[model samples]
Target: MAQNPAGASAAGKPRTLAGRCGSANWVCVAQCIDVTCVDKCLAEGCEQALDALAQCAEKSGCGPDDSACVSRVCGKQCGRTFEPAPPSPEKETTDPCADASVGAGKVPEEVVGRWTLEAASIRPEERPRLAGQEEGVDVKPRPDFESALVVTSGGCFLLRTKLEDATLGRGNTLEIRSWGAFQVDEKKDTVQVWTKSGQAVGPVCGKPRVIGLSKGKFQRPVYTYDVEGDTLTLTAQTPSRQTFQFRRQTQEQKEQAE
Candidate 1:
């Protein structure tokens, strides 16, 4: 019998085709053409074509000795082409919160107590002058108002204010209540309050109107504090720069007043 180019005997002969062509190439040839054609092609020197088909099969992610891939790539190498698969889509990311803490902070133990507002005053330079008023003259009259502050040990606070409304009838008061959490830095002598909720109940526009306070209107009401005996003085550092003197209230006094 004549020796094949692959160094294997013809089919039905003693020698097998395993060593001459690798398992993958043998499978590819078997899938693409008949055994007689494989022997003839090898005899005719089709080694270069077989090598190119194997390379195309590797690039197209064909399984080792895959019969289906051999049939598709080798049998149709003349007209068919192969391309790599597309990548998968990426997952969407989550959005972050604007303010996760919302100004949450700790309050010092020394300043955690109920304080009654004794007096409130504004500096002459900080006060806005009246229209057409003389430079040295101070004509703006102060509004009659009273306020009280309560600071709990749990870092919470409440501020209640009652101002006599001159526009409304006599004895009519504009009552305002604000409550929130407080943060204090004793080393810096500064204290700040985060107003979470508030409301106003009084006569306005010819009727008794209860209006909710604009939450977070006072973004940063920072104040420098000084405690002397039973008195605590808080001087505002932003917004309306004013001084507020408060007297510490005893539990008996608070109960009696309430």
Candidate 2:
């Protein structure tokens, strides 16, 4: 892993693959993030950090095909080829609940439900990054988040809140049923949801001042159905414009034995 160059970032963040993933409750997601960081060249083992970052940008998610990656990484002066993430069992899921029970909600809610935010330093005026993730250090400054969470039917919510261990997140503080409603456009299949409290939700001290959800407004949210094998990615931005991602979870309840 890489660390921030001295006198550069005051908060000495990891500049390499080792320190990127902050905290992941799921095995697959964490592994994917590690792969993504390597693909991004954020890890230090690569020598030149920017060159590595540029090279990594060209890998996996940013690439068009298995070989092509983002121009930034590909265009780096370094004479090298960015290898793609090899196929792995980490991609397999036998649990029926991995996807939604409808037409396009194939994303796993449990994976998609919650997020672990480390920092969101982007400004809204800048090009908005996608709602997804990478790995990094644990949060330092806690933040404030909405009091309510929302979810679709046959679904449940999962989130790492902003409240500290002293207040909202104290003993028995997490309430699974304490969720907000997602307004879905039934006709168009679009959807939006909001926090019942403030726009920001989560630890009061974490970076990324706000974890704005993928579906921006509380009005409508992009929905999921029974689309098979489709990946669901949701990024949240806080007031400070930090970014985070979540993979949606789904499942099928057994019909009562008549």
Tell me, by TM-score, which candidate is best.
1
- Considering only N, C-alpha and C atoms within 3 Å, which residue pairs clash in candidate 1? none
TM-score of model 2 (CA atoms): 0.24
User: What digit string (tens of lDDT, one per residue) describes model 1 on residues 143-202?
Assistant: 554456766656666665554523112322344555666678778998776656555445
State the weakest 10-residue window (summed lDDT) of model 2.
23-32
For residue 44, model 2's alpha carbon misses the true position, in angstroms, by 35
TM-score, predicted candidate 1 vs. hidden true structure: 0.46
Which parts of model 1 have CA positions greater than 4 angstroms off?
Answer: 1-105, 126-144, 165-167, 202-209, 214-216, 238-241, 250-253
Question: Per-prediction RMSD in angstroms?
Answer: 38.7, 18.7
Residue 226 lDDT in model 1?
86
